[model samples]
Target chain A: MSSTLLRTVPALRGALRASGAPKAAGAMASTSFVRGKATLPDLPYDYGALEPHISGKIMELHHAKHHQTYVNGLNSALQTIGEAESKGDFTKAATVAPLLNFHGGGHINHSLFWENLAPASGEGGGEPDGALKKAIDSDFGSFDTFRAQMNTALAGIQGSGWAWLVKDKAAGTLGLVTRANQDPVSGPYVPLLGIDAWEHAYYLQYENRKAEYFDAIWNVVNWKTVAGRFEKT
Target chain B: MVNIGSLWQYLALHSTLSGDSTNTNNTANNLAKMGLAAYTLPALPYAYDALEPHISAQIMELHHARHHQAYVTNLNKALESHVAAVAAGDVAAQIALQQVVKFNGGGHINHSLFWKNLAPAGSEDASVAQAKGLVAEIEKTWGSFDGFKTAFSAALMGIQGSGWGWLVKEAGNGAGLRIVTTKDQDPVVGGDVPVFGVDMWEHAYYLQYLNGKAAYVENIWNVINWRTAEERFAGRSEEKTEL
Candidate 1:
């Protein structure tokens, strides 16, 4: 989700070179000023779909309020950066970088997270099979071992963060990685499945026993999405 | 390990003496106003195990030694960086460092107050009678002490993320008491007096209470240092010796 703007930058420059001077100037406007606002994506299931594992109230607040704040932050940060840069106030533009990173990463992470979840009554919990399962087994010895390792990583986070099942794009090997705060998985890693370890993720339902929330989330894991991302990577 | 002098100095210099909390964005301004002195972890008022049974020694040790220390350490680092940024005329760097400053700064401030806000369960300060003025104000504001407890507990539970619930004295002429929650590491800045604060972050209770946070909240009253709340409420804490 965050890569959209990044991917457009080079493409916009390419258009500028390919067009005539008048069209090139027009392309410059789009490239320099136009920004697509990040929007909160709709959840694939009802707020209560993952109930008993994650409560409806948690889901509602997480999606509607928390996620919405990130979206607004990202848009506001981008607007500030754009306006600052246009005015030649690089300091102002640079000052907004942290907000851009936090909110942008937050927007992207939550967007992916909502999709990676489904109702436990449907395609939620259970282990992945086929190629994804084969890769997990090869990389981590077995599926159970992989799940346990992920849970360990989740538990080990000292503060707000996430544990992810990621595919190393270069090696095509599966591994576990954790990020502090809203940092999104980037570089060569493709996040297959992410488990949010932030207190808000489970403090309401699981309270301080976050391990229960960690263990229970697998009941609605949505391995189908995990498999799709795994194969595509 | 409880250094009474530094705690007194901290409370005197920062929360009360500063007397400039009205602007919500005044954290950086306050840091500059104070000449950007480094912050150190204030010693707890009691031994780690003093609040045991209600709050375990393990929780207090980790909460104070680990969590609060990190905030103090990080806040000083952010301040140092901000100093260098200001010297070099690096506006972006200075601005970029504000969030960390606010977070770690608030963390330091809140934890400092939180430590002094608690006492050993059976200690004299733990009794409501020690907080005579605050109790009268609480009864006036909420109609009854039980009512205030119920409302405060609800506020604590209602926090969606890591934060603190504070019983504060409104800054204006009325000086009314109110329950408020600040998200993440944000302190009850502005002119309001945070008579007492409850750390709602999972680290404060997760070790002993597990998913039973309600039990922790209920048990907390047994350890609350109402004497400190009374001083803060009566506005006598500014005198420094009242505590």
Candidate 2:
């Protein structure tokens, strides 16, 4: 990947030189030169912390292997984009955009997923307490209804995807949204909670019973973290 | 990947090809006629189980008869509504339908290519050996056929979720071949011509390969229709030279 990016540098530089866009050149030089790599964020708790609800094996594999892969992919893509921009090859940059989005989204979603989970001990699982509780009642009627709705949506995902509890910032209303794959929820909405419906997320423990996995996950729900996100949004 | 703009152009082209303009009521009549033509699922060139061992008959049947059919149905529905939106100058409605058009249109386009892209393993005909131009181009771009395969396979394996990996002839003047991936049902667009595509969606492999995506990716090479890819590459070269 690095070699590929290096090869395109001269071509990008040539294109930039031909275009004579001084501002773009300056921007590229400044931005790409100092860009940082995306590193995997450490889990707030140990691998076995969410056990009974989520297994130690699942958390270890999901965080160490899966999330790590995304972090590496995102970094490589960003490096390629930075290299392309530095050389002034917008085409190379454009070609890598899909990778950037996919890996970038994977990183974002997983990071959020970790924070939205807890050990289901004293700190985890139950119900939201203040503004979040009020909002849930207003939007989805009651806590039971919201759980049913989220579970139904999560179970019905045709393939790998996620079920999100999002705050539609523009409308100032809470809504349930489903995104296929690692696609991050788009702007005008902020994801307060996300339920990963991918087979890998539950295939180990639940086998084919996705509904059981969905039901189990609620026990580990970090309502405080959810409420924090809700409060900010 | 299918371009939505060219899809509209294709509707117009279909109308002209069919010679259905005898009822010249207005431009709306032309659009309605084109919309009526709509997109249809293409029949698979071989038996569903033809590419066995590499790809199972069951997988092909569902991927083609069901999944591909759904895309065609949805595309037709979206286009039918789009005709009225276009005639009424309802920009908002037209804009709203853009994603529907892209997703379904792309599914139609990608699967259509995918079906033709595969054949029975070891089924290469005389024409495959004669595809000197495409072979040379691939060599030039990736150093060798093996190198190209390695790169393409890596790209496919890296897909985070449902998507496709493609070997495309990049768009614009002085374009060259490159390996790229598109998330979800996004069609190869922006001037690129997809010479070959491999579906990385789990539905394409889950029943047979299970979670072993690397196995599926590697085995798909056995059934790849190099002749079809060569033809596409040659056709694109001709277009570029003519331009």
Candidate 3:
């Protein structure tokens, strides 16, 4: 009984404290009220790690400058929405939706894209094995076929966008999906691997020869990470 | 039975509601300012195949028909919703709709001008002599026509993303020429007159030029409508670009 009382005392005290607190204070103090700011994730490898295939210069600018802008934009949009909603300015909150969608999707896509790449010398490239290979073969006929299809999708994108290898949730089958601009992969599809086709992705090294960049990217694809995501999904 | 005082009060109220104090006597202009007027896609001055060889027929068709048409359709839709939102005092919807209006509206305005700014590769209007007044101004500003071309081409090449490079005449009396660039579909705003602009968006040259932007830039001068440039420079163009 004494041990039980000891455990119950803290719970009782917490309940009393919560009840006695002012409504605003209680809302503020809730753990759920804390908002996490989106941040630029640290690159897993050195900027120059994917060298020859993708230059160190491009990696530095893309990761440090481009990705950071998205992170900042996402945070700003979130903060604006929160403040607008607090003040009952629903219009202002709604106004921020596009920015939030754009910057938020950019942050999410870049984070996933960074993790999807690895140095060619290490655990990067090569064909997937185990269940991943089976699924790819079953869905796309062969590994080469799957690659060609992804590359074709990448080439078909008219403007800034990404071509993703996605798995339909209900169907559990692999598919190729393309998104315009920074639109995130959502609604029943799980993005397994994404290749950014924005001009900024390869303009410095490849310029107008985007097909070469597409072919070269396959050499540095981190299939291990893709396999992990596939199995988890 | 209305008194003179009441008549004045009603007119004042009407003007305030119409949101056109400056154009109270003009009903059409008032309707336009109040977002009641819808934007339409301006037809290309020349045929789709007119600017071929330099800019392909395929590119011109796609750029004008599909892309510019989408902007016009979306802009009209956004403006209609904005009008309703304003009437209903839905500030959130109005704010949310601002960027779409700006982007699509600018696209319409820019493309409308771009069509008029181009002539056939060897047409009379394409000759530099048609813009003798503007040519002299360009010479004064950048030393020579080649000097100006070199400078403008550099600006176009320097753009990192989709944008436009323009030759604008400064606002006010005795305005001077300036080279400027705007990102995406942003139009030349404020007091300056955009004499001419070059679309640096990848879609503008990607299909034909295919990463050879320098070649496209060098070739564009052959089709430039110097006549239109002269009209815009002299501030006497009949092109109704008031968006």
Query: Which prediction has the highest TM-score against the true structure?
Result: 2
Per-residue C-alpha lDDT of model 3 across residues B60-82, encoded as one tens digit per residue: 98789877876777676667556
Query: What does the TM-score come to for chain B in model 2?
Result: 0.80
Candidate 2 interface RMSD value: 4.9
Backbone clash pairs for candidate 3 read A91-B92
- Across A110-220, the per-residue lDDT of candidate 2 in tens digits comes to 999999998888567998989999999999999999999999889656557899999999899999999878889988989999999876687666555568899999999
C-alpha lDDT of all candidate models, in order: 0.81, 0.80, 0.82
Clashes of each: 1, 4, 1
What TM-score, to 2 decimals, does candidate 2 have?
Answer: 0.60
Give every collision pair in model 1. B21-B190
Order of the predicted models by lDDT, top scorer first:
3, 1, 2
| i-RMSD of model 3 (Å, 1 decimal) | 7.8
lDDT of 3 by residue, A1-233 (tens): 12233255787657656787576456444422344966666777779999889989788878887788888888899999999999999999998898888889989999999899999999778999999999999999999999999999998664578999999999999999999778899999999999999877776677556899999999899999999999998
Docking class of 2: incorrect
Off by over 4 Å in 1: A1-191, A199-227, A230-233, B1-36, B238-243
Which residue segments of model 3 deviate by more than 4 Å? Answer: A1-233, B1-35, B241-243
The C-alpha RMSD in Å for every predicted model, in order, reads 17.9, 15.3, 20.4
